[model samples]
Target: MHLNNDHLISLAETFKLLGDPTRLAILVACLEQEKTVGQIVSDTGASQSLVSHHLRLLRGARLIQPRRDGRHIYYHAHDQHIRCTLQDMIEHIQEEER
Candidate 1:
């Protein structure tokens, strides 16, 4: 598969987004189920503002989807590809710890 310049740039940008620990944690938090910003903040032990910031970035990247229910917004992995990629990375890291 030959990636043209645009595709290559997009791929690089995706990785750059994923390279942030807070953003990665936010994505992982959404792996199993949708979560509210408050839930993510509690789970990740990150500040509410920080989590919200990363959530915006992830949503913009299309790596996550947000649904509004009343005043609350719930976020989840946008597709199985994202879930599988994160799961694979988690498993690989666990293996490395052994």
Candidate 2:
């Protein structure tokens, strides 16, 4: 499919979202289990505020979704598309390195 400039820019932002190691790690962590902000902090060893910041960026890019449970917000991949895209990207990168 052909993407217009705007769509291409959006796609770039999505890939840029994954460009950060912290965000990538967060995505990987969520792949195993849906997690609350606190859980993400504990698992990633990042400060809660820093994790929240990355979460906001991921949510803005539509890579992840947050569900509210009372006062807590649980974040998870919105769909498998992001996961599949990431897997494919990784395989491509590995192939290039070889």
Candidate 3:
């Protein structure tokens, strides 16, 4: 069966979003706790610029959401759906390895 153009584009974007280690790490970090950009940098051990860049992509994808407090912005996973999806992907890979 052939997929529609919109579906293909979405799949491509998902691939692109998951292709970068930083983006994956950012998602994982957000899963752990809602965090500000500085906190994310500390958790991921990535540069502030790098963390922000990944956060931008994840935010763009609607995989994560941000909360604003005073002058600081905090981010967290948009919902359990993404966390569950990531866990399912991990399990699928582990099953293949075993």
By lDDT, the candidates rank as 1, 3, 2
Q: How many residue pairs clash in each candidate?
A: 0, 0, 0
Instruction: Please give the distance, in angstroms, between residue 45's alpha carbon in candidate 2 and its true position after superposition.
Output: 1.4
After the best TM-score superposition of candidate 3, give how far the Cα of residue 33 lies from its true spot, in angstroms. Answer: 1.9
Predicted candidate 3 versus true structure: per-residue lDDT over 1-98, tens digit per residue: 89999999998998789888888888888886789998889988999998988888888889989999999999998888888998788789899888
Candidate 2 local lDDT, residue 18: 86
- Root-mean-square deviation of each candidate, in angstroms? 0.9, 2.4, 2.2
Worst 10-residue stretch by lDDT in candidate 3? 24-33
What TM-score do all the candidates reach, one by one?
0.94, 0.83, 0.83
Clashing pairs in 3: none
Lowest lDDT block of 10, candidate 1:
52-61
Error of 1 at 90 (Å): 1.1
Local accuracy of candidate 1 as per-residue lDDT tens digits, 1-98: 99999999998999999999999999999999999999999999999999989998998989999999999999999999999998998999999889
Q: Which is the better candidate, 1 or 2, if ranked by lDDT?
A: 1
**Best-fitting candidate, scored by TM-score:** 1
